[model samples]
Target chain A: MNRFIARNGPAYAFLLPWFLGFFLLALGPILASLYLSFTRYDMVAEPRWVGFDNYVYMFTRDRRFWKALNVTFTYVALAVPARLIMALVVAMLLDKGLRTIGVYRAIFYLPSLLGSSIAIAILWRQLFAADGVVNRVLADFGIPSHAWITDPNTSIYTLVLLAMWQFGSPMLIFLAGLRSIPRDLYEAAEIDGTPKWRQFLRITLPLLAPVIFFNLVLQTIEAFKTFSSAFIISNGSGAPADSLLFYTVYLFNEAFKFFRMGYASALAWVLLIIIAVFTGIAFLTSKYWVHYENERD
Target chain B: MVEMTRRKLLGTAAAGVAASALVGVPALAATRIRHYWWGNPERDKRTFAVIDLFQKANPGIEVSGETIGWGDYWTKMATQTAGRNMADLVQMDYRYLFEYVRRGALKPLDEYIGKSLMIQDFDKGPIDGGRVDGKLYALNIGANSQVMVYNTRVFQEAGVDADLINWTWDDFAKACEKISAKSGGKVKGADDLALMIEVFESWVRQNGREFYDANGKVAATVDDVATFWQFWADLRKKDVVRSKDKTVILDVPIAESGIAVGDTAMSQFWSNQLVGIQAVSKDKIGAAMVPHKAGGKPGQYIKPSMFMSLSRDVKDPASAIAYMNAWVNDPAITKVLGLERGIPVSQKIRDQLAPGLSEVEKLSINYFTAIQNKVGGLPLPAPKGAGEVRDAFMRTGSDVVLARTSVKDAAASFIDDAQAIIDRAQ
Candidate 1:
């Protein structure tokens, strides 16, 4: 026991700062938010216990809440699948032993690295503006261009494209997963006269299932928590009649703009629950499709 | 192996030192005041100079200046104030003064005034604007009023007369049409209908029906707001004014405004924005009185451009108040800041800064001085949910213009949303 402790003591000591940060910074605020969800805290005055009022109001009276939820889910529905498919396809392309694959990987990973940054969000806003590069291209094609960010019908699509463009991180993870599958598996399938499409469908996809599941869970959580792009592109209030009002953005407005801290806390907790439920569903549903070589034990 | 061990020891020692340092420091050593404001580059330069002056004036005081664009300023202020970590001294706007005061975020200046500060003679309207329920929560830094800014070159090209002081909305529309026709659509007359709201609010106030009642209730009727929107709708249909691009509404620093930058021939803006407009457009830009209804009251008021307020949580209220007094009352600082924050409220500062001003600043100052005697009261204190109300207006207005909802329905919906926001806030 002493030898074991001596061997691992430095490692445990090194992790102490992160653990402390987790408990004090992350966990403390999270717990405070949980407590605040049950009370009225407008920041100016002391908190007053008003159990379930904020949650009740959010679920019942707040149309903005419902609108935000719908927008967020719509975004997740469109963004998550589109992003995963794009990442997977790109990862496969990169894995094909092409020349300058390192450069290709870096180029593909750049947007994801830059994702969630304010500068990139600003760029996204400008790229989709009325006379932006996208619209300028459309204009050159003799098409009448409407204000993409300002138009309610097309604003969400612009965000979807923004989200889809940041598929780099997932692509890198997929590439790693692709690399891990032994070459002998493909060699065996090929020697058995299996076609390229069948080999990909049977071997490549099944092996990549775990990675796909992981990316889906992560991307969905990220999509739900998205705020910067929507906030920046819409100039802090989801523009054109709340078309771009995502859940987190609405929560921000409630907390900061309206000073409804209790309500925002409630919204945050509800969002956590939603994310938890989605993740739980993903895990539960993964058993049928996900092929794990290590599961036999 | 010796080198690796030495390096590892050094790393461990460094980590230990850092950990100990973090644990040992209970509070920051220096007394640092985090000051925040919103302004353009010119204002930023002058503000930093003033900060340097203030630091030199009081050697013991160390101030850290933080600035953001105007659009993000209020949001950051609200968040920080709510979190009880507001800056010691904050540059505030009139729209948020009442809300901040009511929330007890701003320190009342009654005690600090007359002792630590020397405010010159100004009208009771502006002075009272900083007060709520008999407590002076902020100090007026400067004031401005709404005015019509026209491209003189465009007017000349269109053969329209230079004087537009007594021009009615009908006359304004006719002039816009003429300008558009004459310019062959290379220059639009006006950008959008949102500008009409400022005129409507002023008009309504002059008519004894304010946007919000004295009781902080929505006083304007559905028909009142409908008629306001209808005026613009009619003008838009007449091809006199172009509809605002949706994306442009999201952009700030209105000096980038299509009208102010010469994409459109005319615009309505606060008198303070004339300097910024001039900077953007090198061509001839001129000011005129906001066109009023036939035989109607002038309805215009010298709006309190912004205010400087001390935080309630400030450790040293006297020092903060002194700094604010210097910024507002001192002629030297005012000269540096110029009309960037608007015209100075102090007569001494105004006189001192007026002589060396550029042609554009002089024009704005002269135009404002010409109407200062006839101007009405400043706009009323915006209610707690005023931001939401403005957003609701913009949203519903967009809906109406986009034909997603009828004007009447949009107006009614806006009233409903505005009322709900007010009630929720209450």
Candidate 2:
């Protein structure tokens, strides 16, 4: 033991802060919440062990929970693909040889940095308002407009648009992926009398599959965890007929507003399991499509 | 040489830590208490000034003030309560006072009432308004009631009577239709009042029913809710009231409400919010009673705007109670606060501050003053799960107005969910 401690003491010392943080802050709360998922706790009173009552009620009776799941799933389904496509399109444009490409990249990246802020959420709300700038611009063409943010049917789409607007991070990663592809492959395809569209399909897409898979997984997880924008635009009560009630917003309301901490804990575990299932599916299917250059035949 | 320097660095850090600990021990002897409140900038300024004065008077007692917006206040309070580190003096809402007290998160102030907490001059009604289970757990900070605030200019432009004191629901509806017609569809007549639970409570009372009975169960029925929702739905269909979109826009601060922005002629607001509404409006603002039920009971009652309660685990009860006493009874503090929080609960403080009040302030004071004696009995304290019930009720009401659900179906589901929540909480 003494020899082992002497050999690795400095490395252990360097890692102590992170180890302490994990055990005390992250791990403790996670385990506590797992235990709390089986209870009835209103925060002020003692938690009573009800043994899956919260989960039973959530699955069988809580209509709002189902609504939240539906909203979140719809948001994820739309936002993930929309954001990835926008990122790839912008990234492909930036891949062209231009002297001011760096400046354009910086400008495109500004949105992701400011996207999740409360101010941006408020601005997005105004932009989609009934008489807001979008409507004014649309009215110039003599097209009738509707209240975008307040209309239940169209409100989630506004959030999806906001997600699309913040395609900066993935765009950067895609730009890196685009640059790493060899120029000679495209040149050789062109010399062999391949059209631009066919060249893209045969060469560019197969090589970029790994990057696309990476972005898809990352963006899908981030979309499921969306809270602040939904919370702010919905006015914190999932307003306008609960159409904007994302999963995290609903969990936050249940935990804090309604003081249903136990139920919220149960909801949180269910969400974790859902995200895990999605990620596991992505990994298990990756071998069929996402090929690595260094892999053995 | 490098090894010697590293050892010296470690010794210096140890010495610095030891010196700070020695300094902190002396500072710990002085009693420090935290006060938490939810308010806007104006209330924060006044509350901080009062805390400053209290700290100056009692040199050994250091009082720290914390304030948050109303939206996040209860969430923070619940987190603090769960951590067993609630502020010594907690600013509480009436709907939450019962929950906090019943959960044993708040200390009963009855034992200290005659001693450190001096509120003998306060009115008995306000005092009793703070009680739960016959125990005084909080002290009323101010008294106010619900009212309909209207723009006088809109009434004149529409050539409609502005006196809403005796207007029945039918008369009010006719007036609203006339106002909308007069505006040529530019200005809505009133906000969608069905969105507010407080306004619905008054309607329930006007119909000679209690919202919640003595047993803390829902006393208002599905028919009552359906009738109220259908009335607003019919008004919405006629475009006499703010549309669902407009209502969503105005569901913000009182200063940004429909009446304040000239988009609507009138809206339902707390009696105290008239001053805030008047401040933002270019038109002449006026306060009047919410329309009555023709021959039914007077629904309006004096409500404690908020309460100052002591945490059950307050480290220094005497100091905290003394601050509460000064906040309620001190003439100088009352002048600084004015009618911003609500009308002062103490008659002496109200009379003392009456002479220097602004015209807009007097509008709220007069509105509450005239109705103080004639209003009905106070309703029972809201039950433990009332917060959830209120939000669910508002969502259901919005569903009705947005035409997403029929009034009867919305009311039925709301009643079912509210009863389930209340039952599960018990």
Q: Score the docking of each candidate (DockQ).
A: 0.49, 0.65
Best by DockQ: 2
- What does the lDDT come to for candidate 1? 0.81
Q: On residues A190-237, what C-alpha lDDT tens digit does candidate 1 reach at each position? A: 899999999999999998889888999999999999999999888888
Query: In terms of TM-score, how similar is model 2 to the real structure?
Result: 0.95
Q: Clash totals for all models, in order?
A: 0, 0
Given the true complex, what DockQ would model 2 score?
0.65
Q: For residues B214-313, write the lDDT of model 1, one tens digit per residue.
A: 7888887788778777877777776667655632364355676656567777777888888888878757888888766666666788888888888877
lDDT of 2 by residue, B164-241 (tens): 666788888988899999999888889888878888888899999998888888988999899999888889989999
| CAPRI quality of model 1 | medium
Q: Per-residue lDDT for B291 in model 2?
A: 82
User: Candidates' TM-scores?
Assistant: 0.91, 0.95
DockQ of candidate 1 is 0.49
